[model samples]
Target: MKVDYIIVGLGLAGLAFSRELEKENKSFIVFENKSQHSSKVAGGMYNPIILKRFTPVWDAENQLKIAIPFYKNMELLLGNKYDYKVDVYRLFTSIEEQNNWFAACDNPTLSSYMVPKVITDKFNGIDALFGYGKVTHTGRIDTNKLIEDYHFYLEKSNKILYQDFEYNRIDFNENKIQYKNIETSKIVFCEGFGIKKNPFFKELPMQEAKGELITIHAPELDIDFVLKSSVFIMPLGNQLFKVGATFNWKDKTSIPSKEGKEELLTKLKSILNVPFEVVEHVAGIRPTVKDRRPLVGLHKEYKNIALLNGLGTRGVMIAPTVAKELYNHIENDMLLRNEISIKRFENN
Candidate 1:
């Protein structure tokens, strides 16, 4: 079969790219190996504020502006709301930290998103660490539902091929690329950590890290917004909460570990006074780059081949803008950002 583009991996990057292509009435095919992975498992939080040092995220304002509209449009197309706009209550752990947050809020750069407020009586069994600040306009994507709905849409449109990609099956010619008997003018890889095996772009600085998360059913905690201290508690409805995510830099295994569970349990105990049941545990590797940016560009020698991976943990927030940028570059002869282009590793 012939198509305009072949997209590998059906993660958020692939989905976002395909969504854009569909918007422009372009033809494409998507290949997905697994039904679930980092994208679906992710809490899908899009926060403009970085709490660690109280600084704004890079280009957050523009990213959020593009993302909010994109997801809303998708929701309209799907006839179901899949994204949410909510606030994040970052719990403070100390009086000193509270004072520091207040000071930081006064900074013009931080004041818009950060609201100085002490959350005390919001929930039951709450230990007053220090206080909390609200991050307005923060929200999460219901990635699980989005993926399912998109998969169904693709199936209905007959645009998805569910199989493991075999590199040996791909044929490259001077003018085109073919994958498993399907010919396309260009092929883009959105394969996440799987990019490590792509001979063309393996040299790119991708620091793949493993992350583990657990689901807890805490009926006593009626928190509607995301709660964060060291770890984050995202409300998943039905008195169920998704808590997690321990980052393991050295280990890249996707299997949940006993140590991960222990870490989550320990942290959960510190924040909640109510009893909860551990329901689910999962782990996946994030396609993180060393410079903490996405890698998007065409192969120097093979102009018809491109990569659209390395979204890291912020794939939900970054994918829309980057995909739009990539689409413009491919269709209108625009330039990819030097910081995200693969040229940086050419000499290495």
Candidate 2:
């Protein structure tokens, strides 16, 4: 079987790239090893606000503009409802922090989302902090639904190969790449943290981290928006909420651990005043890079080979724009941004 592009990994990056290729009416095939991974387990929150310092996220405006439309178009194309643009209520922690936020609201960047007064009595079951403010233009994608729909779409199109991609099976040539008995003009690796084994791009700075999340049935918590303090509490419908996740930079394993569970339970006890039942637990490694940016470009020595990984923890927000940019660079003679290009580490 021959195709214009062969994408490895069926995560957000791979799916986003495939969607772009489909838009351009190009041919491609995708491969996936696992049935579920990081993308499926993600809460899919696209927030413009960074809660730590209460600052705006990187390239928030451009990324949001590109992502919202892309996901909406994908929803239309798939004939399914998946993406939703909603407002986020950021619950304040302390009086000092609340004052700081109100003061910062005058800044040009935050004026659109910040409110003057704090909200005190909107929620139930927990002692109110200073107050809560809203972050406008926040949205979320139904990642599991999107992945399932795309998988079915790929199967219907006969463009997916389900198997573990062994590194040794791939044979690289000057103008093409081959794996097993299949060959393609170009091969793009979107293997997420699995890229650590790719001989061509292993030298790239990858700060792989494992994240764990737990699901609980909290009937008393009727909040519709995401709540954050030490850990985020995101509603998952049916009186269920997802409270997670612990970030372990040292351990990159995908296996769920007892320590993670205990830590989450401790955090949950501190935030919630209602009765809940523990339901599910999940763990996955994020393909984070050192500079906290995606790595997208052709191999320095291999022209027909490219990489589209390192989306980090923000894969939900970053994948669409990066995939579009990568598609253009691959199909056209365009150059990738120097900050994200693999060329940055060529001499290292």
lDDT of each: 0.86, 0.84
Tell me the TM-score of each prediction against the true structure. 0.96, 0.96
Candidate 2 regions off by >4 Å?
none
Flag clash pairs in model 1: none
TM-score of 2: 0.96
Worst 10 residues of 2 by lDDT: 121-130
List the candidate 1 regions with Cα displacement exceeding 4 Å.
none
**What tens-digit string does per-residue lDDT give for candidate 1 at 8-68?**
8998999999988998988999988883388888888999888877888877888888999
Clashes of 2: 0
Task: Give me the candidate number with maximum lDDT.
Answer: 1
What is the per-residue lDDT of model 2 for residues 1-348, given as tens digits with 9 covering 90 to 100? Answer: 778888989999999998888888888888888833888888788887787677888877788889988888888888998876666766687888888788878878877766667777657756665777767778778888999899998999899989877777878876777777787898889989889778888889998888999999988987887787788888878998888888999887888899999999998898888889999998988888898889999887778888999898888889998998888898887888887787787787
